[model samples]
Each structure stands twice: as structure tokens, then as C-alpha cells.
Target: MKKFNSTIYMSGKYLFVGMLLLALLGSCGNNADKTNDTGKQKREQLPAQAGKEKAKTIVFFGNSLTAGYGVDPSEAFPALVQEKIDSLHLPYKVVNAGLSGETTAGGKSRIDWILRQPVDIFVLELGGNDGLRGIPIAETSRNLQAIISRVREKNPQVKIVLAGMQVPPNMGRTYASAFRVVFQQLAANNQIDLIPFLLENVGGISHLNQADGIHPNPQGHKIVAENVWRVIQGLL
Candidate 1:
């Protein structure tokens, strides 16, 4: 397990370096075919705590996968997680902050706004786009580290879950291997929870994915929810 021994902060120098190193695609545009849900999936609002009573909150932050791009919002894993939370009577609220084409840079820019209120758990699910585009691994790592730092800085007690992702091996064994290592290194360096493979048992499985072969379908999301639930149960 990683050790959390230091208070985190975003170093301006590092952010400036990361910014200079990027020529990545636009953030608000559509996802690539692998990650896109064909732009046909209808978006839905997540479960809300109607009573207005105060409860700890968990936020799912990422791109298409987190957005449930090709599936109903209710079928998203985060929503599934909310279902579990409610059924178990856990004292927590769920917020899904996913966007179809969001990258780590986009996420870093918007994290503070998302942290407007206290959050008990923050699940960081980004970097897939970075790997897909073959952006500098160093830049991807820095952006994620900044995100994790900002989250901790905002809520010192918040538990962070870093979701690991993989690009096709066609990206080259060296690149693919390095990309996978990025998440593991971050998890260890930050001492946060890690989901080794976000698409475990689902990736490369035709039946579990939409036509895109990138984003998971509703059924695939059920397994994704299980992947996350196992790690977060103790924290909750």
C-alpha cells in the first residue's frame, strides 16, 4: 500500500511545464471511436438525496467511461454505485461529474469548481485519452498528480481512487507498458486507492461493449461497479 506522508499541493512550475508540453486535442469535442458511444446515448441525471440532510459525498470524475457515454445514466457504474449505497444505507451521497471527451488537462482546470463543497471520497478516472493520443507520459502523470494533489488539498481527509486504464497494444509495447505504470506509480506516490484495471473482464469483450469497442455497455458497467465496490466498501 502507498503511504500518505505529505500534504499535497500543485507546483506552479510543474503545471507550466505540463501546459507547455501539450498539443492534445480539444477537451469538449467528441471522444475517439474507441471511447465514443456514437453520440447517440441520451444523458440522464444522477441520483439525488432529496431529503437535504447532510451526508458525506463521493464524486466520480473522468471522461466517457465515467459519463456512461453510450448507456443510460442510470446504468453508469457510478449510478450503480449509488444504488448500492442507498440499498446498504450507507451515509454518503453520489455525484457523477463525467464528461464524454474530458482529458486530464480539462479535469485539472475544472477540479476546483467541482470541489466547491467537502467531499469524502474522490475517484479520479482520467488519462485514457492521454494514452490513446500518445501525449507525453510525463505530462499525463503530472496532470493526474496535480488533480490528486488538488483533491487532497481541498479535503485533506478525502480518500482518492485512481482508476487505471490501458490503450491498445498497437500503441507499441513500450508506450503501453509505460502508460500502465503511470497509474500504479501515482497510486503509490499518493498513497491512494487504485483500481488496477477499470475495464477488467470487460475490455476486448465484444458483447460487453457498444459498437465502439471502447466504452462499456450497460452490462459491462455492472462489472465495472463491482470492480469499484470492492475497493471502496471499506472507505465508505
Candidate 2:
């Protein structure tokens, strides 16, 4: 009887030891699985963050002129700007957000959303549509002022290049003079880079203009790109 009792006790001891070992192995396996999952999540997130950090963004905000209205996308001045930047091996992306017929107020309203994206530079071109529509020049100027102010407030380090526009001479001398002065005065007061008359040497030239006599053709876009490059290259 004593022998049987001792044998029973030994059996119970071995069972306990075996169960403990199994439990320990199971726990270790679970911990390893958890570690692998965590590592995978971190690896997945790294690429997205790296892509965001690596991308350099530039926004072109303006009216039809910036849109290259009636022109091919590849031949547009913004695309040309991209080409030039690529040729120089600059690490940046240019986003053309120009809406045909957009006035200063239109630009001001949409600027908040536009700025939400990563923008290193803003090629601001507006007021041309306002001038064409015969809107009050003061109102146009005020809207432009607000746009610039808001952009600066949101991104203190962002570079700004303002593109100037001219009212057609047929739009009365008073209106034309006021329209031309708006860009010049704003640029002078704010100490901003200004491209005097975005359509310089191309406007009214039937060869450069499209059928509408307003927007530039492909060849004209090349000239426009040159004008913008002169101002923007220095900024970069």
C-alpha cells in the first residue's frame, strides 16, 4: 500500500511538470505572434510616411491663363514649368489648379481647401476674369489681398509669385488703368515677386493667341512658361 501511494504521488508530480511546460510554450508562442504583427504594422506605415516626406508640391492658383485654356495639357505653361524643373533636377511637383473664368472672389473662396494640400509655392494668378467681367477693380484688389493674407497666415514659409494681368484696352481707359494698377500696387506694398503682365508680348498677337483672342495657343504657352520661369527660378 505504501509503495502504491508513493507511485501515485510521483505520477501526479510528472503530470504537473508536463502541464507547466506546455503552458509556458503556449505563452511564448503567443508573444512571438504579437511581436510579428506589430512589426508588420510598423513596416506598412513607414512607406506612407516616407512618401509624404519625399514629395515636394507646388500649386498654381489662377484663372484661364494658368489653366492654359484651349491649350493641350502637355503644352500648358504649368507642364512646361514642370519640364524645366525636371531638367534642372529639382525635387518638386507642380499642381495646376487654375479654373477658367474664376474671379478673385472665386480664388479666395477655394484657397482654404487648396492650401490643405502640401504646397511649397503658390503661383497666384487671378483678377483677370474680374477685369474681363468689368467687376469693380477695388473689389478685385481686396479679394486678392485677402487670398494672399490667408495663404501667408496658413504657411509662413511658402513662396508666392503673383501673376499680373491687363484689361483689354477696349474696356475703357479708366477701367484698364485701374486693373493694371491693382497688381503693381499689391506687389509693391507686400514686397512680393510679381510677373508683370503674365501674357507679356503674347496678348493681342493673333499668332500666339487662340481663336478666342484671350487664351494662348501651345506656342504661346511656351512663352508664358518662360515668363513664369524668370520669376520663379530665382525664388526656388
Candidate 3:
């Protein structure tokens, strides 16, 4: 009887120890699972955090000049501007929204589509086509104003830069003067920044222009980029 009792007591002791060991192992497994879950959550959040730090966008909306007509797209002034920004390590991404022959009226029609994406700085380079086409000064002004209004409506914080242009003397001095005045008036009235002349040094120079004498060549684009940088650097 004594031996049997001792055997029974030993069996009970072993069973309790086994159960304690199992409980300890289960607790360790739960702690490890909790740590792994936390690590997984942090990994998932990393991309979202990085996305928040992505570069801001600058939209250069214009016509053939901005499109780099008769030249490689990389040789365009907007691309040159991008190169300058990159060289300075600026936190901006330049979007060249330059359609080859877009006028102010056309730009007005499509401004909403362009605004579908976020635009931090908006460089308006229309009106040159309007001048070339001999569009009415009032009509051009109204279209440009409407585009500006729409941009402001979409994003009140957007910084606007209007590029001033002058029609050829052949377009008539009065008409040419009025065309040039439109940009100044709009810039003052809207309280926006202005690029006094987008093609300042490159406009009438035969060597600086392409064979067409209207669009800038690669060398001219470098000067245009400098012109743009002077105006936009302060804003940046």
C-alpha cells in the first residue's frame, strides 16, 4: 500500500510540472507573436510616411515655347528649369504642361483638367499664341483671367507666375502695346508674380532662335531657364 501511494504521488508531481512547462511555453509564444505583429505594422506604415515627404509639383502651362517646338523635349526651357531645380536640390517636381499651340482660350478650357492634380506653383505661359493668332486683346485678357480664377478657386494657396509677351511690331504698335500691357495688368490686379519677358534675350536674336526664328534653340533655352529661375527662386 505504501509503495502504491508513493507511486501515485510521483505521478501527480510529474503531471503538474508538465502542465506548468506547457503554460510557460505558451506564454513565450504569445509574447513573440505580439512582437512580430508590431514589426509588421511598422513595415506597412513606412511607405505611407515616405509618400508624405514626396516632392511638391510646379506646373508650367504654356504654348510652343514651353513645348520646345523644333527641338528635343529635353532641350525645352521647362526641362532646363528642372535641371536647375535638381542642381539646387530643390524639393520640387516640374510638370511641363505645354501644348504646342495652346492659346489663352484653350488654356481656360483645359485649366480644370490640369488642376485635377495638385499644383504648388503655376507658371502661365499662354497669350503668346493668342498674340500670334491676332486674337482680341480683351478676349485674351478675359480668358487669362478666367484661368487664373479657376486656379485660385481650386487652390487658393497656389503661387501664380505670368509670363509677359509682346507681339511683333508688325502686329501694330497700339495692338502690340496693349498685348504687352495685359500681362502687367493681370499680374498687378491678381497680385501674382511675373516673368517680365519669357524670351527676353532670345526673342529677336537670329542665332539664339531656331530656324523658325520664333522658338528658342537649346542655347536660348538655357537663358530662358535663367530668366524663369530669377523669378521663381524667391517663391521657392
Q: Residue by residue across 104-175, what tens digits does model 3's lDDT show?
A: 989999999999999999999999988988999999999999999999999999999999998898899999
1 or 3, which is superior by TM-score? 3
Model 2 per-residue lDDT tens digits across residues 1-236: 99999999999999999999999999999999999999999999998887664657889999888887887888899999999998987778899999988999999999999988988888899998898889999899999999999989998888888999998888999999989988999999878899999999899999999998889999999999999999999876
Model number with the top lDDT: 3
Sort every candidate by TM-score, greatest first: 3, 1, 2
Candidate 2: which pairs clash? none
Off by over 4 Å in 2: 1-53
**Candidate 1: tens digits of C-alpha lDDT, residues 17-135:** 67765524433333464355544332222234344557899999999999999899999999999999999887798899998889899999999999997788999999998888888
10 residues in a row with least lDDT, candidate 3: 47-56
Clashes of 3: 0
lDDT of 3: 0.94
Q: Where is the poorest 10-residue window by lDDT in model 2?
A: 47-56
Candidate number with greatest TM-score: 3
lDDT of the candidates, in the order given: 0.89, 0.90, 0.94
